[model samples]
Target: MKSNLFISALFALTISLASCNSSNAKPQKKVETEKPDSAATTKIQVALLLDTSNSMDGLIDQAKSRLWNIVNTLTTLKYDGKTPDIEISLYEYGNDGLSEKSNYIRQVTALSQDLDLISEKLFALRTNGGSEYCGAVIQDATKELKWSSENNSMKLIYIAENEGFNQGKINYKEAISDALKNDIYVNTIFCGNKTEGINIFWKDGADRGKGKYFNIDSDRAVQYIATPYDDEIAKCDEKINKTYINYGSKGLEKKRNQAVQDQNAKRVSASNYTDRAVSKSKAVYKNESWDLVDKVKNDANAIAKIQKEELPAELKDKSTAEIQAIVTEKKKERETIQKEISVLAKKRQQYIDTEAKKTKTQDDLGNTINSSIMAFAKVKGYTVEK
Candidate 1:
């Protein structure tokens, strides 16, 4: 009886131990993920070096007409919820009108945020039959331009030419090497067939700079599909222009140039005008260097530094409070116009998308640029909204 009683107690203790062990077991844990550092993001800098020999007239025309579309496409991109500041520099090479001693290369515009000034410089470009110095221009641009030292900034040099890439005194290989040393990717766009461009060493030029090469039909005219919203956007842009109160020495001249560019866009096509209007509506369209309204908004002490005589005729006699009130009124008006353009731009884009699907054509310089830029941007972890 004692042995049987001891066996029963042993069995009870074994069951209790098993229950305690089961209850003491730990639960499985979930894997934790780390967030990305947003500070790693940077801005984009683009230099367009175009061969402006007499044969490149069509190429120049396409560039002028499509500038707005390119600007608009860039505005769609964001890095870590912050929009990247864009600066574009323009260069014209192989134009006899330019000095041969300088390899027939002219820096039309320095890297600038002033989109209107860029447009003006582009429109002013006139082609002449000149020696196409591919190597020399690339070298000069690489060495002359102030490229960003930031590792994250996208510094690109797009050289568009129809001639062989090995032209001029400077060696193409060495020039491209210099570009690489500066972290500037030199992209080559040949105005011919892919095989032809490859045979001319255009592809090799791009490869040396660690960039892509493309061959495009430079003579192809840009086709525009007019949208119903184009008229309204153009009208809204005029209203938006009215809100800008010109101040400072350059303010009046730059403001006048704005209207001149509007006309130039219209000369190209209605679609171009509409696209320019859309670009103007974006935050990238800034005139802070000269415009009082833009300057004052960004700098609190701007008004105090400005000479009273530099103020616009309407604001010259006004008190600081009165000037501020005028600026406030203009800002409100500008915002309303921008919002309207934004809405219309969306509808215009949707219409464009549906129409683009039906066509079998390559885009002009604008879309070509947008394609290359977005591709490079993706590699840098940028988020393109469009």
Candidate 2:
């Protein structure tokens, strides 16, 4: 009987040990990680606030003609093996056409990737006599636009005006303070002589914001040294237009606007058209919402979401397989054209640089903005390929 009791106690101790070991063991868990957005990793937000009073017609013209130059400069920037999305917002201040109650300022466009629409607005700007309100416009732009919060994003405001920086009810100091609070670098381009600009407090405005100050000859005409590659680049741009399969209600209209912008750029000069084409070939010229090829490439389920009736007239009755085939073909063609354009643009730029060395060209708004962009871009870990 004592031996039987000893065996029973030993059995109880073994069971307790086993139970404690089991309780201490951890259960297997399912770990999950979030996927990165393949589209864009970084962004460059630029706000171009221009004075458009009657005396500043030259400034307006420079803004309109040299927009593509500014865009092309941004196109060369890259960080972490991905090109940044470029969002540009335009503001025209001191135009009498604008309401006095609104301080003669208008937010022409929000920060967006719609390059064509931006070109359209720039072309449409008309000068009028009005009071120049530097503070009001900057404050409005700072408060209104949806600026990126990413520390990597290069956020900047280039306010070009030829008037006293302190010529408004809203103090320039307060505007600069607000801009700095939002992590926006406010660069001032005084559209006159350097001494005159400093006397008018333009340099002070830039100093307060810790941004660059330029006294540019805004009235100077943009010089384009036409290269042998310009014609080929222009042809490639036209070929790209054919690849766009317009879808949705806005597709046709948007596609038409693209053509219109091309024409407008051409009207400026052949080199201007080439610049626009080069910009279009880059990743920043996205029209996914309207272009069927871009839409399908980005989202596999995009076609499934779209109603049959919403498709372009040419693609309305096509079967799903047939539609996919069409998109694939267009995508291939566009890629080829873009590659050709890229090659030609490099050659064109080389030619332009060689000529710039031989000429005594006055500094216009384009080169001025390009200088600032390149300087800032380097600081933000962006490398310009050319």
Candidate 3:
């Protein structure tokens, strides 16, 4: 009875141990969002805000021609195992700056890759009157434009108002509050004035919005491309070049691994089946271990009757060598693509430079006409912080 009790206790202990092991073996959370092909990772949206105040025609020209350069720069950029989500929205605020027009807060275009449309809109715009900067920020821009704060997405508002904020019924303070609420980055590019008060108001708006601020000197600015088309093409090439090198290489590596897996699986299966057949044969006849001899004989016979040639088919896997070759081949392909990207990028930059010259020509013309206006600004002692 004591022996029987010991066996019972041992069996219960064995069951308990098995249950504990099973529970411990379970994984916590299953991982979702498996890594996809290289192309699947890049996505970022950008908004370009233009200052259409009477003084920034040349600046606008630079922006139109250089649209691609900025995006191309981004292609070389890397994030935490992800690509940027790139989109562009064009908005010009000075349309209302120059006028009491209700539609002055203009959305030239929504988030898009069609940069040409933005360039065209920028080219078509004329600098005019009123700038209710705070209202544009607090009301139209922050509250109205399509953006998601929850996605932790890259949201930006590039504001280039030449003058200060004067429009919004809501005060500058309120605009800051709203910008913080939206988690928006408002990069301010001030062209004419570098002094405080006017430009500083825009600067503070940018600061509150958690964005960078830059003051571009008209004379110092260089147009990096000859045309908007060239800019777009170069920018695109830069992206393809950068990503194809990294992502394309990665894709090829995966294929190589797949090939190896295929090769390995075949060999493993071939060995496993061969061993199983041998073991069964020994057990049935050589050892006479099977109590059901006839049944064991039949099973062994059935196993032997199975086609051995089919074992190779079951075991056939794509070899690692084959996969490695594919990787090399893809790397070569990407190198070729990268060279093309470089050429195209160079051509686009040339266009940007050419466009700069043309825009400068326009700037010269405006400078001639706005001489009195320029003199008035100088005379007013109205200087913003440089």
**TM-score of every candidate relative to the true structure:** 0.88, 0.91, 0.48
Best by lDDT: 2
Model 2 CA lDDT for position 358: 97
Cα error, residue 367 of model 2, in Å, equals 0.8
RMSD of each: 11.4, 3.6, 22.7
Residue 1 accuracy (lDDT) in model 3? 100
lDDT of 2 by residue, 1-386 (tens): 99999999999999999999999889668786865553264789999998989888888878877899899999888877678899999999999999999999999999999998899999999999888989899899999999987778889999997889999899999999999999898999999899999999999999998898999887777777888888888888888999998888898999999999999998988888888999999888999989989998889878778889889878889888888888899999999999888888888899989998998865788888888888998888888775
Candidate 3 per-residue lDDT over residues 1-386, each given as its tens digit: 99999999999999999999999896779778886544344334556667676666666655643443344433433334343445667777655444455445677787764433443455567766555364454456666677754333555566665566544566766765676577665556666555753445766765666665556554334322223343333333334323221112233343343234323322333322221221111111121121112222335443233333322232124353443344355445544545554555455445544665665433321232123222322332322111
> Which consecutive 10 residues in model 2 have the weakest lDDT in total?
32-41
For candidate 2, the per-residue lDDT at 34 reads 67
Error of 3 at 13 (Å): 32
Cα-based lDDT for every prediction: 0.87, 0.89, 0.47
TM-score of 2: 0.91
Clashes of each: 0, 0, 41
Off by over 4 Å in 2: 1-39
lDDT of 1: 0.87
Give the distance in Å from residue 192's predicted Cα in candidate 3 to where it truly belongs: 2.7
